[model samples]
Target chain A: MEHEKTQIERHTSKQFDVELEDVREQVLTMGGLVEQQIANGVKALIDGDSALGEDVARSDYKINTMEVAIDEACTKILARRQPQAGDLRLVLAIAKTITDLERIGDEAEKIGRMAVHLAGKDRPPSAFRQISQLGGHVRQMVRDSLDAFARMDTEAALAVAQHDAEVDREYEGVMRQCITFMMEDPRTIKHMLDVMWSVKALERIGDHATNISEYVVYLVGGRDVRHLSIEELEKEAARAISPRTGQ
Target chain B: MEHEKTQIERHTSKQFDVELEDVREQVLTMGGLVEQQIANGVKALIDGDSALGEDVARSDYKINTMEVAIDEACTKILARRQPQAGDLRLVLAIAKTITDLERIGDEAEKIGRMAVHLAGKDRPPSAFRQISQLGGHVRQMVRDSLDAFARMDTEAALAVAQHDAEVDREYEGVMRQCITFMMEDPRTIKHMLDVMWSVKALERIGDHATNISEYVVYLVGGRDVRHLSIEELEKEAARAISPRTGQ
Candidate 1:
């Protein structure tokens, strides 16, 4: 009787591990969706495509649904498995990650709307150039952060957070230029501001990526580098940025 | 033997409910911390106080630490109790909420940094006016969404989500103004964009709050509102959004 019970216990534990992987996999799947949303949202803006923006808006629901489903899965696992130690940490981090992905999706959708709005506008060369530059940095940050998340790489995550500060400096530059544009032609305020909103959305996306990196640190190393300097963390972080993947 | 078993089962179940409540309470505590972080971060920015921004920077770790702790708590309860149905949803939603709060905190911190950067500069009056408007909306959204959440009010959550569109509109206006500002005087691009970044931070805060409100709907009514009209969801979500303190 004791031997049989032990065998059943081992089987149950294995089953729990499989289920935990499923939850992680689902959260990762959702991460992919949110990442796509960010990219597509940015594309919609740059391409001046309202249809693309609308698609992004529609996809937000799927993102929201995935979030709910993943939350359910993690909760169910936690309740059933009573996982301790490392498993517990992994489950908790994924749960936190779903929330990050969902927000990232929203930012993407916001970008879509901005794209639709900006598609027809005539933009100043200098102002447009910097706006585009800020957007590019922000988008790269999102892609890298998501990669850090998938690879369970704290180093990549830290790099993503540090990258945000540079965007900040650029954003500062963009705003100064925008102000002059506004002063030059009050008529320009409407279009130029759309560019500004898009940059801001991208920056927030970067912040979410940083948050994901922080989660990576907690998941693997079990250390929270959130309050510390990215400079310090980067000193020890993987020197490479999270691979841009398809580039 | 049967009587003893029955008594033990009832005792254990009650214990589970209490622990679940503990998880819910902790999630709230985390939310409160992040919310305060955003407020302080924004205030730090507005006042040009590096100290306040530094304070936000300092608080990031604690927020992250608390996130892990609460996530652990949820996983622990789920593992040990194996809560079904409603209890499971509570654990999961609270877990998701931790993430949203952390993002909100990060956005606030970014705003604080921008505030510090802009402290030394002369900002456009119109830009400041719009920034204040966006800030107020975001701040209100955060406060009321949490209130709706604490109360499990779906209507409140829907209301918050609806308000997000308004913030978007404001963001659009700010962007237009900034772009115009930069065109006329390239020299002001940096300062104008700092203010714009701060506005963007506030707008993202509102987005996070809206996310919190959506989760509130799922938790309270178990309904999925991802694809529905706001009007439909608002009407159907009464049970979810209604303050259910008595219930």
Candidate 2:
């Protein structure tokens, strides 16, 4: 009777592991959709493709749907499996990650809407170079943050968090340049305002990515690193990975 | 023996109820702190009080600490008690609600920083009237949303969500006015930019409040009302509250 119960317990544990993996995979799939939305949103703005812009904006519902589905799955896991310690943190992290991902999708949709608004406007001589650069940086950050979460790599997560500062600086540069353009010619105020909004959305996307990376660290490192500096986060991540070095 | 087992089970269940209640109370306390931060942050900007701005910015850490503490307590409860059904939903909603509250605190801190920047600069002739109005509107929304959560009142939550549209309109008006001010006088561009940032932060605060209200709806209604129109959300919330009325 003891041997039979052990076999049953082992099978249940294996099934729980598969369920957890399924949730993680779904989160990554959602992350990929968000990344694509950001890219298409930016592309639509830069290329003045209103059709693409509208498409990207309309497609945000997909990300929203995924978020709700994933969250429900996590809730079910918590209720049924009663995940403990590391498993509990993993489930919680995925729940939080999807929220950030959904917000990132919202930001991308905002950018898409801005793109449609700016489609007929006069393009500055700079051709939105700074905004384009900032968009690229943040898109990469989002991708890296997801990859970190997928691999449960603390170092990669820290790297993604550290890149946030650079993204912020790039965002500042874009804002300053837009202000300069508006001040130089009052006729460009409306156009520049749309550009400013788009850039701001991109910058916020970067923040959402950083939040995701923080969740990755929390999930793996078992420490809440929400408000910590990158340096402090690095220390904590290192300690989480190496027990003997930890204090 | 069965009677003794029932008594022990009852004691444990009671303890779990107290734990859940403690977390909920802590979340409300944190909400109160965040509401104060928004109020103070806006006041600091409107009054040009650099000291107050600095204080508000510095005090954000208190909210951050509370968020971490509350989240940890929720995780502990989930692991130990494995709360089912309604209790599980309560714990999850608190987790999500605190995130929005923390972000609201972050927005308030941004407003504080902008206030410090604008304090040393010229105040607009219009005296930031639009921003102050927007600030007042969002502050009330925050208060109302927290009240809705405390009472689990679906009607109140729906009301708060509906108010978000008005807040968005107010935000757009402020943006338009700021742009006009900058366009009329290039000299006011820098000052107007600072005012714009403060108003943007206020607008984001409104979004956060809407998020919290959505969480309240989800907690009480047991339905994901996110991405739903106010009308649809009202229908869903009503159905969740009264099954006979549900379609």
Best by TM-score: 2
By summed lDDT, which 10 consecutive residues of candidate 2 chain B come out lowest? Answer: B238-247
Q: Is the docking of candidate 1 incorrect, acceptable, medium or high quality?
A: acceptable
lDDT of 1 by residue, B1-247 (tens): 9999999999998888788777777777877787688777767766667778777876787887887687668767766776777777777778777777877877777786776677677767777777776777788898888888888777778888899889899988987787677767666765766776677678778877877887788888876555467787787687553556445
Docking class of 2: medium
* Per-model root-mean-square deviation over C-alphas: 5.8, 2.0
C-alpha-based local distance difference test score of model 2: 0.91
Query: Against the unseen true structure, what C-alpha lDDT does each candidate score?
Result: 0.75, 0.91
TM-score of chain B of each: 0.90, 0.96
Query: Per-prediction TM-score, please?
Result: 0.74, 0.97
Off by over 4 Å in 1: A1-62, A79-82, A123-189, A231-247, B1-68, B114-138, B155-159, B162-192, B224-228, B239-247
- Model 1 has a DockQ score of 0.33
The alpha-carbon lDDT assigned to residue B154 of candidate 1 equals: 77
Residue A158, model 2: Cα distance from true site in angstroms: 0.5
